[model samples]
Target: MFLAWNEMRRNKIKFGLIIGVLIMISYLLFLLSGLANGLMNMNREAIDIWKADAIVLNKDANQTVAQSSVNTDDINGKFDKSEGLKQTAVIATDGKLKENATVFGIDAKGFLMPKLEDGKLFKKNNEVVADHTLKTKGFKIGDELSLSNSDEKLKIVGFSESSKFNASPVLFTNDETISKLNPMFKGDKINALVVKDKNWKDAQLNKDLEVIEIEDFVTKLPGYQAQNLTLTFMIVFLFAISAMVIGIFLYIITLQKRNLFGVLKAQGLTNGFLAKSVMSQTIIIALIGTLIGFGLTVLTGAFLPEAVPIKFDYLTMSIYGIVLILVAILGSLFSVLSIRKVEPLKVIG
Candidate 1:
């Protein structure tokens, strides 16, 4: 460790340059991760806010909430505790200010509805609560908003945080209002049911119904799985590339110090000491670079535009940091090997 520190102090510029490169790479990885998480939340934040243990969808719907069809009869006595049915509909607003929005039909008094950030939940069929994203589009409490296909005008009564789905702001309304908007969803029929029972998997239901955990249901969202998989693959490959970069750089550094190492060994120093120094140096560099990257990620997220979705989860960031340090240590393995191979006698001669 002392030798490694001495070498770094002696060649500050070279090590600084390597650290700079690592910082850039690590920052990019963290930024991409935040963006990926943000996009995913945009697609499922509405459901995520529900905090339901599981969702019951019609088997024929292929695990899609939008396609599933259920009613009061299907949910009766099916679980230890079941919230009222929830359904979703995509509708365009009448004016140019708002284009497309997802309307969520939830029972007004049910547990699935999110708490309001502003105003209270809807008290009448004509009143509605909406995601705070709608505020950016010139909407406010008491403003009457009309759907593109329907004659009914809904009054915005409240707004909630993180209540978006399918990359659009969500509007909350009762089943009765939804039925008025689209006659197809008649009395007691809904898209799916949110259940809170541990034994849901063992419960026997109609052959046409299927129960799935909320996590699985989120992946089933359109394009969500594919997008997340692509981002995750990119992150993995980037980490691998970082490891290779670190390994190659450290290997070159080790090669330059081969004679010094040989001389130390001739003077009775051990290979294990040199290997530990190399690993310690790698860890220090990696940790500094990763922390800088994390700081930049947080700064960027703080200043990002409201329209841009970017979520920075602490747990996710911590995991990424751990993985980066591990990969960096793994990358130093080649340098350790090079140190182990040094020949004291030949170099001394």
Candidate 2:
């Protein structure tokens, strides 16, 4: 331990550079994990809170909430208790709010309405529930807004937490208003039916109406699977790079101090003590750098804009921290083995 402490003091700059690299890698891992988790949450949180056992969509429409179409008959015939929703893209603009927005027309009295964080749910044709981000972006209650897909000018009736789907802030409205706005909709039907019953028989559902689990539907969103996969690959490669960087730095340090190690071995120091010291130094450096990096990530997250989705939960951070420490320990083991190979006889000659 004494020898390891002395070596670290002797080569502070080299150790500092190694520590800097480790910090950067650890920070990137933390950021990427948060990003992946955040994106998934943004796409699915509203659905997640529904606590519904099943979601019914059009069988031919695949899993998209926006594309699936189900009539009242499709739902009333099978589902014990169900709410119809029409997830469509209609351009909306408030003369005062500025910028055109995509609207998500849904049933005001349905299961979806309960997710509203503030104000009242949509009740009238003129009423709409906007996401919190939009409120910051320039929207307010009682503000009259015009929807482009249809002829209706609506009013903001409520606000919801940052509910976003396909990167667009969601706007909640009654099914009647949505049916009037969306041109693609054929009848007074919904894009999908949110089912609350667990005993729903999929076989008995209307042949055209497909019953999809909410979890499965979330993955079907365009680019969701691809985006998630790309982020996962990036995080994994960074972890590998972190391990290699630590190993190489310690290896080079051991080589530079070979003569000194030999002198100590000849002076009655056992190889085991020298090896343990090197490992202890590696672990100490890894721990200090990781902690610093994690702190930086937390601080940076505080300033991040709501538009830049980054999710960090305790479970995700804890798992990543554990992996970082494990890799650092592996790097230290290499240094310990190298220290053992330093021969006293060679140095005396």
Candidate 3:
């Protein structure tokens, strides 16, 4: 510990550079994880709220509820403990700013109907409850939203929590409003069904329909898997790069301090003591850099717009921090091994 601190104190700028690099890497990783998690939440927040066991969608819909279509036979199938759903995406406008939003047609009394955070659920055919984000966009109770592609209009009766789908705002309405909003999906039909039994794995019930776990349903949402895969690869590669950067930097320093290690060994310092210093140096550097990086991440998140999808999971961040420290310690193995191999006689000779 003394040798590690003495060298770090003597070469403050070199070690500072290492810490800076680590800080940037850790910051990027944390930021990326938050964004990925937030986006995932937005894409499937409604499903999370439903707390449903699984989803039943048309096989042809590619597992996306918005693209699914359930016929009368499918809806009336001898299924038990399920509620039908009619879902679609439409452009909403108030004769001014237009934006895309998702409309969910669910039974007002079904288990899928979330408890209102404010106001009441839809009591009439066209009365609807919207996500609070819509309220931010000038929508409020008693305000009418015009469906651009259809003659149907929605009366906002209430507001729900942060329920979103396909990275867009959500509106909850009855099946009547849904059918009118999109005539093609009209009739006694539904886009999908929500099952209450978590063990509902009746995939082969009908060749045209399939039941899937909630996680699988979320994973198959449009662009959800793609975004996750891309960000995961980037994070993994960044971890590897961090290890390489630390390992190479320490290796170069080890090369420069070969004679110093030999002289210390001659002065009666055991190689084991010198190796402990190297490990201690790695731990200190890793902890300092990661903490600073996390602080910066939180600071930046505070300034970001509300629309930015970022959710901080402190537990996940802590686990990442531990992994980073372990990786850094592993990186310093090259230095530790080099120090252990130092022969005092060779340097003195």
From the highest TM-score down, the ranking of the candidates is: 3, 1, 2
TM-score for each of the candidates:
0.92, 0.91, 0.93
Clash count, one per candidate: 0, 1, 0
lDDT digits (tens) for residues 115-162 of candidate 3: 687789998998989997787777778878888788888888999888
- Ranked by TM-score, the better of candidates 1 and 3 is 3
Candidate 3 lDDT at 59 equals: 91
User: Which 10 consecutive positions of candidate 1 have the poorest summed lDDT?
Assistant: 87-96
Return the clash pairs for model 3, or none: none
Q: For residues 191-291, what per-residue lDDT tens digits would candidate 2 score against the true structure?
A: 77788887865448666777777677788878889889999999888878888889998898888888888989999999888878877887778887888
lDDT of 1 by residue, 1-349 (tens): 6877788888998888778878888898998889889889888887777777898888999887777788778678989888765555656453545657877788777777777889889989978888888876667777787777788888888987767877778888887888888776887778888888877888788888888998888888899988899999999998998999899999998898888899989888898888888998998889888999889888888888888888888899889988998998999899999888889988767
lDDT assessment of candidate 1 = 0.83
The TM-score obtained by model 3 is 0.93
Best by TM-score: 3
